[model samples]
Target: MNQQAEEILKFYERQGKPAGQEEILGALQELQQVLGCIPKEVQEETAKRLGVKPSFLSAFIKKYPGFKEVSAVHEIHVCTGPSCGSKDALKILRALEQESAQKERKEGISVKIVKGRCTRRCAKGPNIKVNGELCHHMTPEQAADLIRRL
Candidate 1:
């Protein structure tokens, strides 16, 4: 385990119960600042130490924007549900993922791409949410361009 994971385990052990969402969020924020993204192993260890299932931690990471790992500037989320899929959502998603990976390799910082179910903008079809802003009717190329600009 990494030093951060060790520290988290020790802290939780001292506390005598599972860490709450706020505590986990705070730890995750610190971890992201120190280590970029939360490593899968660290997340698992954190879940174990807190006595919560890994799925719970995963769910928390998905639900809370603060827990997301991204550069200080922005984060990206794409809708991949049935409605969005009709608009070549998978292609858009792949483009964004590739863009994020390229940025990470070049800049040594991470960008997040979260896939979510309907943002209730089914009318919008393929929609994307960037830094909490909703974008409608995006093509794969457009999504890639948007990430480049960000």
Candidate 2:
């Protein structure tokens, strides 16, 4: 049995029936959870289920950050905003990226390091977020430790 798919379906059910665009977004996000990145077949199927146009789905996927065309098992986003950048954010990014490579071979962990404009905690400067958990006052050692333990 496809337990993950079933779980995703259950989540969709709890989300209620989306009438328009909201429904389309909700369904796509759920499918992304199950399928990693939505394939063409899944996109078409979702459009048919939601009674929305394929173009509409395409636009949403293009615009929304949550909808990814490529999926990663782990993602680390580093803030490159003025405050964080001034506080050695790039060093943290490099450290994490390097650690990701080493761990990727050792444990088969797929990591993607992304640069973000801001995480909205300027006072925290040198901020980063792993998956979705925000970290404040980042350092290379801290970043390396976080990714290594994964």
Candidate 3:
């Protein structure tokens, strides 16, 4: 085990078995502080040390909203499948990126864009979901407008 993993394991053992989400988050934050981003291997080791399933750790990480808030990163999920992409999804993404860049300068919001496949909304082709809200038939200009409004 690496030094970070060892430290995490020692911390977990000291805290006893079945640690809560807050404790897990605290450990993850500590690990990140010590070693930057949490590596998958370290996550697995941390899960093992805490006597929790790897999936449990992963789910916790996914559900933890603290990272984005603390890191000043805003996540935008854009669908880029045959349907959405064909409908100018790239244009929408570019527009959103530009808008985000402007917002970052004025409002200080750091936006991170993620391209998603399908999103199971092909029927709504040209669809984009901002933080999970499905916005269908969105043009590039509309997408830029939407991000600014958000």
Candidate 4:
């Protein structure tokens, strides 16, 4: 087992009980909290340790917000809420989508682009999240520059 698998198993073992739905969920949540995303191999190892089917965890993770099965090299989320919309957030989203496509084709780097709702930072309209880190006051040119830099 790799270090990540061992660390995750250790967390489960510390619970000192047969892994139930709650315990497994807690473990997965902890993994996401610490690693930002739960890797496929880690998820499989976790399922094995919990004595449950891999699909169960896979489906469960998908249903929950803020949990990802795999971490992309770059994940961009452009807020499309009313506040952001008024600030041209969609334009930035489009720019990032185009730039990501071009970058992937030229350099083979994987990027995931998502349209996100308000992050409750209306004062900072036109917000974008790059790899889960927030950037406020974003413009299409800035978004394109970010993709190129990444």
Instruction: Give the clashing pairs for model 3.
Output: none
Off by over 4 Å in 4: 1-72
Q: Give the worst 10-residue stretch by lDDT in candidate 1.
A: 65-74
- Deviation in Å, model 2, residue 140 alpha carbon: 0.6
Better candidate number, 1 or 2, judged by TM-score: 2
Give me the candidate number with maximum lDDT: 4
RMSD of 1: 10.2
Model 1 lDDT per residue over 1-150, tens place = 457656756776566557777777776666666666665566776788777788888888778765553344467888988899888999999999988676654433466788975788999879999889999999999998887777
lDDT by candidate, in order shown: 0.75, 0.74, 0.73, 0.80
Between prediction 1 and prediction 3, the one with superior TM-score is 1
lDDT by residue (36-69, candidate 4, tens digit) is 5776667777787777788988898888887875
Error of 1 at 113 (Å): 0.7
**How much does candidate 3 score in TM-score?**
0.50
- Determine the C-alpha RMSD for candidate 2 after optimal superposition of all C-alphas: 11.5
Stretches of candidate 3 off by over 4 Å are 1-72
Residue 81 of model 4, lDDT score: 90
Residue-level lDDT of model 2, residues 1-150, one tens digit each, is 146745654555555444366666666777777666765555555555555677777788889977765444798889988889889988998999899886664444678899975999999878888889999988999999999887
